[model samples]
Target: MHTRALVLFSGGQDSTTCLADALTRFERVETIGFDYGQRHHVELAQRGVVLREWRARFPAWAARLGDDHVLDVGVLGRVSETSLTRDMAFRMEAGGLPNTFVPGRNLLFLTLAAALAYRRGLTVLVTGVCETDYSGYPDCRDDTMKALQVALSLGMDQRLLIDTPLMWLDKAATWQLAHDLGQRADPAGGGDALVQLIVEHTHTCYAGDRTQRHAWGYGCGACPACDLRAAGWARWRGERGAG
Candidate 1:
């Protein structure tokens, strides 16, 4: 029997790259997305389209896979105090923790994902939490992931592997991996594809602003997320130009 994986997908650049990465490693791949009442509902809608496109583009893989699941794990919605789920007015920070942090959001999502994986009899779960690019978030670190994996195993009495392919990699490296996987083509597109995808298709703005475009994407550009994305894109584009 070949390895099977369940991906925690959000249709963002990192998660989509992880999806492509899962394709190379698993015999079958299925995705699970959670709607935790994000400030930006447009992203949730875009996730549906992206998943549909992926299924259409990879029918053979889809045939071997189990049904992709999307659930409303909106328990956090009621209790979420972060700007990501609340109406709290916040300003984008430079290098500090932003209001976009949904308290215990990843923990809840992965807990649900683990339960779903156990129910599906899958021992492996893939996530795209890049610590290098966004370590300011408490949940995106390796320690939190490992602790969750351990807790899930202890709680469920079954061993599970949480794979983080982009855990240590930076934005440029992630773009490179997506390119290597043929999910992206051209250096120009390669450098900015993730940014564009993140901007237009996925929503990272805490304000939920769908209007206007920034250097990084459709963001305030002052937010931590946009700043990191912009810096990475600029660096990658400069390198591409020089080469």
Candidate 2:
């Protein structure tokens, strides 16, 4: 029954998929992106570009998608020394979380998104957090999101639903979901435009290297993000071919 939603978007593949999914399910959908001083700040920049492109590509769905709000939380970057917020090399040593794991990044993001939703009378908050192919971030877990949902509701005195459509889905399944949603939203004969939008426009690279382009999108192909995305794309192609 929750018709209004705010998606915690990062302009990445997962988030962009969530946004596309939201546009289909929600009566009104808005997006919130953060500038928490991440090293790949280009993701934030690409958010605006993605929104603009979506508006042009699907004019009928544009109004329902609503506006994208980018918040400035530069202090998060200043206080956190994770590789994602600095120029450090990526490392995921045994028995330890990766350096790319930004501490409390999702927690802070969801908290702020909930606050915004509460203020705006939105009852649902969508996030693209997935545990299946995630980077071992504790906050991205299902239990964490469930607990946060209850806490946010109790703390804000509002019934808030935290939607995680990608929770159980791997990257390939995520791509499939995007493809399905895109096709459903297509106004023309085919949904190739929507699929291309996701493939070419969305930014998923931790290194944020747009110069190094690939079939999936822009990224430093060496980074973990890019590797995961590439694997997913390959799996998706394999599935499509087999089908």
Candidate 3:
């Protein structure tokens, strides 16, 4: 079994939830983020806040949380002309994908993560990329991940495993997963505390607006990312109230 893991964390709702899950499962968990010159660079800043809060809040999981890495891959922005890398409207592109889709972003991230994991002797790599409740990004698909895992293992000559816990889960289920993870980590107030932490601390808005806060989280409330997050929060709440 892979006892150590390296998570591709972006300090967003999904990545934070994935990190929490990793902390619960792995004996050692580390995080990696990229400085790709994204529009929502504020999310990068929130990474430290999330880590600190986790240590203060969940002592059990804090033991498993290890080093963090921020790679300076600003060349992604220079090559990709997407809305995330440039000031462009969020719309479908000529390739029938959202403009927010940064080509080769996830590919490079996982590749780099594999290299780092190899050096750290970590056998597992966890990512928050999801097909459900996500913008239409081909790289986010399960098939792509599987292929990449195969190729990476062959190229690196190591039995590295790529785990995507959120691949089939939608946003609402993602919220529930975080709640369950928190409950397992700190039963006293784990679920509620984690949800609250995610809402207040994680950043998902494409516009990088932190001054404005909403019931779901902090965002501009109009971008596709915000829309998906808000809708998931509403659905999660509604299901809980119904139960």
Q: What is the lDDT of every predicted structure here? A: 0.73, 0.87, 0.93
Best-matching candidate per lDDT: 3
* TM-score per candidate, chains pooled: 0.83, 0.96, 0.98
What shift in Å separates residue 42 of candidate 3 from its native position after superposition?
Answer: 0.6
User: Which 10-residue window in model 2 sums to the lowest lDDT?
Assistant: 186-195
RMSD of each: 3.8, 1.5, 1.1
Q: Lowest-scoring 10 consecutive residues by lDDT in candidate 3?
A: 234-243
What digit string (tens of lDDT, one per residue) describes model 2 on residues 14-35? 9988988888999999889998
Candidate 1 residue lDDT tens string, 96-192: 7777777788888888898998888887889998778883788989999999999998998988888999999887676667656643333434324
- Summarize candidate 3's per-residue lDDT along 1-243 as a digit string, tens digits: 789999999999999999998998899999999999999999999999999898999988888899999999999999998899998888987878989999899999999999999999999999999998899899999999999999999989999999999999999999999999999888898999999999999999999999899998899999999999999988998999942
C-alpha displacement of 107 in model 1, angstroms? 1.2
The TM-score, computed over Cα atoms with residue i paired to residue i, of candidate 2 is 0.96
